[model samples]
Target: MIRLALVSNKLQKIQLKVFDSSTFSILRCWDPHLSSSRSSSQNLHDPTTHFHNEEALNPTELLNAQITSGELNEDKHQKMVVEELEKVHQNLQHYEPAKSTMFTRLFGRRDVMDSPKGIYLYGAVGGGKTMLMDLFYACCKMPRKRRVHFHSFMLDVHTRIHELKKTISRNQTSKPQPFDVIRPIAEDISNQSWLICFDEFQVTDIADAMILKRLFTELFSCGVVVIATSNRHPDDLYKNGLQRSNFVPFIKVLKDHCDVVSLDSGIDYRTRSSVGKDRIYFVKSETEADREMDKIFKMLCSMENDIIRPKTLTIRGRNVTFKKTCGQVIDTTFEELCARPLGASDYLQLSQAFHTIMIRDVPVLSLKLRSETRRFITLIDTLYDNRVRVVISAETPTKELFLSEGHDSGHDDHRMLMDDLNITAGSENASSNIFTGEEEIFAFDRTVSRLTEMQTEDYWKQWDKKR
Candidate 1:
């Protein structure tokens, strides 16, 4: 019996040593039994260990370290936001997820522990909201956590809802009810992630707007905490959107669950250091632009041994063809990319396939090209989120790409739709809910901000590292 006990103790020690050497060390630190007895500094000598001490995981500490290292400039606004995020990071360290009991499940009661209030950080374009949020998300040690672009999250939500409805249709044994799938979908998301960080949170689509209230209500009830950064305030979201009255309650829910913070420091940080530093964006005559793009393309292609050829990407059973591709680089035109009917999903596929994209002949956009403008916005958003590099040849400078003065003729189709729905100009909600080019104009500011940032050396370096 003494020999058996000795062997058992030896095996347990070996198992612990293995865990401490691997990435699982972080998780082991969260274990109550292990954490109670172990000092955080005990693993400091081992360089393989991720965090040296509990303070190492603090978002504020990390932010200040970056500032000290000159990787980031000291900004009072950014400092304040990180201080708030530090509180959240500390709270999550001690958070224990409440488990559902059989009695609670049977009675449809959620027995959930109170979670820390999430944050909603809003500011003007080019502010450091995303940068701070990213710092916080990286420092969070929770295993059940997710960081996603808001548009991508909504797309996933819509896809899941569709699949769920299809499954219900195929299941013959289940009795048909009202067919509401939001609660179940929310539960699935909550099970996957207890903390969700969203970048660029906005609501423009009516389909998404209508479901926000129920979805978030269920998520909050399930103790799923949310942290989001946006240009618009919660009340300003879905402004002038169709059936926006129904979406207002979601704003209330969001405000009730989150402490809203404004990070407008009167400084556009992204534009301060990097504008016009990179020579990728060329504003010249068509012929001159073409020559410049061809020269750059050839230079890039020479680095790869693969022959230049046309590439086709199949997304959702649809084929999207690019005329020129060399290995992971694609040379396409603005007309070919934005003139066609493409969306977030299509752009996402392109971003995945290409490390660098060269776009030529991007003309000054007006309301007449509203569809193309919207597509361009989606493409930029997806590419930026994925850290994909973009080179552009445009008719005007980046700041002048989108013209603000144009007749609202592009929204005639919207007006016709409203007329068909018996929502006339005289209707009480027509002024607020009518679709127009103004929303596009408002969104173009963000697109312009991103485009300017894309031209910076730091942005290119980041993309190269990601590639």
Candidate 2:
């Protein structure tokens, strides 16, 4: 029962439970705000003293401390988010509700109580939404709590549905409706976790959209609370999809259950983080380029030792190998990725696994290497659709990446390829043309747009482990 005491000039005397390390990071700053009227000899054995001095500061002062110390750059909106999150932290810290068993309820001895209302924090890219959520999740004292990417959570749900279908197949009962499976799934989830934190919560799949309302209803009934972060507000979720009206109830359910907080900090922190950093570099010397790319990989990986590791991704029974990987970042060569025969499915699998990709030494695409260029187009399309971050070292700039140098012998100018496809070079509809025979040239405009956007901090913020 470790306790944390928060002292402010105007707040009630609130004592909170110290559940996890996040509480320590958030509370250590509160030392400076110690009320001056208090006695100096209070016999308090504070556990957080090892990290910070006896002095405590309020949330704003704590944020200011980070800015002054150069640990974090100051953002006014991010500070406001931190302040709001502090209240949530306090609520969660003091949250202590008795568990209700089925026997207790059935015997007419149940106590009526309400669970803590969760928050939905949504905002533009790089607004520090995920960062604040991480702080909240780290300190939340709930014994049964889970933090998962929304796509991965849905993947698990679909996988469970398949398994449930198998069980029903083996049984002698009549066929169960698809909705019938929701109860068992929701019950399983609620039994395991009373609190769920979802990152990048959006509904793109029709199956997911259909099940959310019923599934969440069961979860809420079982006292499960949800905390989520997303780019869209509750009403804007599942926007413009097939049978979207069927998904409307879930929006209402979400609104009814959670308080929506918009972290409209207007600052692109990710882009700010990337300023002057060479995410994409044009190099004349291959050796110099490789060395620089290696350095970037090490920096992004945050590796103390300069040991590069090999990582393998098994896609469709074929194993693809990467030379360097740490956390959600992967470093590989363009030759290994584009030169080899890989399709959209492989790139889609790669996108789901890695958030940031550092590809080195991308040679300018010409008609001679048409197959590789086409594969590269597909790779970029998949990556862009998934909002994965891309860093590259290339012989040419992004605008010149797909311009044909010549045919196989490097003698024939390849503008004729576009002419043969009857797509003019500067045509207004060129970006939307998909039948140029040369796939790379057909998709070049949009691919270039996505590649350029990927280098921005806003793009980095929209990045998700899954679409």
Model number with the top lDDT: 1
Give all candidates' CA lDDT scores.
Answer: 0.76, 0.62
Model 1 RMSD to the real structure?
A: 12.6
- lDDT string for model 2 (70-111, tens) is 546677787777777667666666554445566754453224
Where model 2 places Cα greater than 4 Å from the true spot, the runs are: 1-65, 96-112, 173-179, 274-391, 394-467
lDDT of 1: 0.76
Would you estimate the TM-scores of all the predictions? 0.84, 0.55
Q: Which residues of candidate 1, in runs, are more than 4 Å off?
A: 1-55, 99-109, 173-175, 275-278, 409-411, 432-434
Q: For model 2, what is the C-alpha lDDT against the true structure? A: 0.62
Query: For model 1, how does the per-residue alpha-carbon lDDT over 64-175 read when each residue is reduced to its tens digit?
Result: 7666655667999889998898878888888755655556545764777798899999999877888888778778777889988999999999999989999988885767
Q: Give candidate 2's error at residue 188 in angstroms.
A: 2.3
